[model samples]
Target chain A: MNPSARQPVRATTSINGMIITVASGKGGTGKTMVAASLALSLAAAYPQQPPLYLDCDVEAPNAHLFLHPTLAEQQEVGLLIPAVDEAKCTHCGKCAEICQYHAIAVLGKKTLVFPQLCHGCGSCTALCPEGAITEVLDRMGIVERGSAAAGIAFARGVLDVGEPMAVPVIRQLKKWALPRPGQVVIRDAPPGTSCPVVETIRGSDYLLLVTEPTPFGLHDLRLAAQVAKELNIPTGVIVNRENGTYPEIDAFCEADHLPILLRIPFERAIAEGVARGKTLVDIHPEYGDRFRQMFLQIYETISHS
Target chain B: MKILLTATSPSIDSNVDPRYGRGAYFIVVDPDTMEWQAHPNPGIGASGGAGSLAAQFASNQQASSVVSGDFGPNAYNALQAAGIAMYLFGSSATVKEAIENFKAGLLESVGAPTGPGHHQH
Candidate 1:
């Protein structure tokens, strides 16, 4: 199966500035490439207003490769897991019954709490009938902050492997950035329509969905679009590596009334440059103007709508 | 002495189930009177803590020992805490044969859990 295709777009009827999140429902679809390039171009176009670029793909954050930001600030992000007080825990199995994730188990004098399976929703702790369960801080990831090229403020969360959760890290990373008027926050979201994706795109003003021209791309793009529709987030599609061969994506977008924002043609040079950790706009300076124009068009559509 | 055996089928002729918590059936037997009863493993479809729940069921059955192909960490710990001895039964062996072997003192006692519950929900 191809792990590709996903993007999120953003449009605001009330405001011009937006927290545009770029996502692909699947992985390895160049969400990072588009986010880094767009953020850099927007930063270059407006020097007075540096966009806040947040890499919310904490599980396997790769935006740092293209942005090359020297993270100056680092902070640990944690989740509160349930800690049972055996004295009060009468083994009624209430916590286990309430836990939808099966992170807790009460087995006759032995109470087992698997923190890795915990979602940190605090359901077990809050719903405890005996008040035996209490939430405890458990570190799961780290949030780093710095600045990249074109004076763009950068922040990304890195979740420790095998942590089984990324929402907490993404939430903490987003908390670090306080949105200001005229501040365009470009959040780089993780792939898939999972909890992490929902967490990354939550509270965002706009979504910039980056997709490809393959069948896998169209399929995941539809799923991502449905999510945005449900969340009432206005979205636009960016078709990467567009060679004009696949008409399926175009047809789908037209049928759904979704505008095709920017089409970056597939080029070997672009791929080679990205291999060495360079963004498209950075490698080919001419694309900077095109990306800036694309950014303006996004805001224009929002204003018009 | 009463004993609990994990089986793939209700009959003692059925092969022993490799999985402890998610096993298809559990047979409770009183060796002194050869009194036997077959019950479906309730934890078989459990999302998580199937092992723990299965151990709790075994404790409720008041079985002195449990025989299975393998035991997960949680299941093993719960069984140990419940003071129930566990024995490893060969995968190819049937429930009746495993119990007979146990009577002959041929069953190997499980000292600890075989591995983590990677297959658990």
Candidate 2:
């Protein structure tokens, strides 16, 4: 028997339910690859309670390329933008005064509202003295839900091209695809440690940070790690295309106390397969068991901590 | 008519600020009387929508014309809607020089936005 094939120690207790978010500080660091593989492995391990894969990278959702889920349901997501009623407005400049985004401005007799700049915070509407401000739904994106291989539940949010904010779309996606009890959830978060990434990883039980063993990867990983620390979430690192050339990543991880959960060595065949819309598990069937073992380890670590 | 000039400092002798949205100061002056009042720009440190905020300030100050090196789309639209003329001045010119050029009709009126809308952070 191969030493790598040895079975990993499984947790004695049930996980009940857990949300594992896969994120990266830099783009093209294999976040979707790890997320899809984990979902596939989890679904295979627990066929009775398959995992749900949510692509929260609304601005550039690409998990569907691997899972190819048949999206049978779709819902439009929007933000409520302020609409000023001129008849009731006194031109007192109160609405503009309260808007932090500067989306609304009272220019003399005209009240100008820039819908694209609005964050949908509703502060303007609530602060309008004459009750002239009303909120109207402005469509920004859409959320789609369906199932993939092994009956893995899949959902993804797609933001409209040129949309400024992706937080609203991600928020609506999570609300639309509420996971059931005892069901595992794998969220594919967007790249960068900004508001969109924060919105996706907010309520997760565990965060799996994916990165390559490169200078850019290490730089962004540090920033992403800061966000994880700030959010107080238990995080693990997965190094993709690992060639052992960059020991700095490991050193930083060891110093930061962020456990290195998995390291996927660089391979030409894997890259070619992934380029053709194949998941890591699909290219390497044995990785399915490996992913399951990683999941169990995460559960055990989180439970203990 | 009061001419609003984007300035680097609160004085007319200061160099003209190239950026209209993130201008350091706004010096409103009557070109005929040379009477002026300088106000620190409120939009200089804004995270976003600085152009719109600066435009709103210009309208609130009742400036009939604006002089800057470049005008962003939001500022251009608001100023055009408010019927305030936009004139482009060289960065080398001082606030007083830009205002003088506007009165002499030597400055070019910008028919469209000279720069992109949002600031890249």
Tens digits of per-residue lDDT for model 1, A1-305: 01121122343222235678998886777899999998888777777777889999888888888888989999988888899999988888778777766567776675678676677789888888899998998899899998888788889999997776788888899898655666788999999988899989888767888899999999999999999998888788999889888999999999988888888888899889989998988789988888887777776655554
DockQ of 1: 0.35
What's the C-alpha lDDT at position A185 in model 1? 88
Instruction: List, for all models, the DockQ compared with the true complex.
Output: 0.35, 0.57
In terms of lDDT, the poorest run of 10 residues in model 1 chain A is A1-10
Error of 2 at A209 (Å): 0.8
lDDT for each residue of candidate 1 in B1-121, tens digit (9 for 90 to 100): 7999998999888888888988999999887677799999987777666777788788778888999988987788778877899998863378888888888888889998888765421
How far residue B67's Cα lies from its native spot in candidate 1, in Å, is 5.1
- TM-score evaluated only on chain B, model 2: 0.94
Model 2, A269: alpha-carbon shift in Å?
0.9
Off by over 4 Å in 2: A1-15, B119-121
The best candidate by TM-score is 2
lDDT of 2 at B49: 81
Q: In candidate 2, how many Å is residue A11 off? A: 6.5
Which candidate has the highest lDDT of all?
A: 2
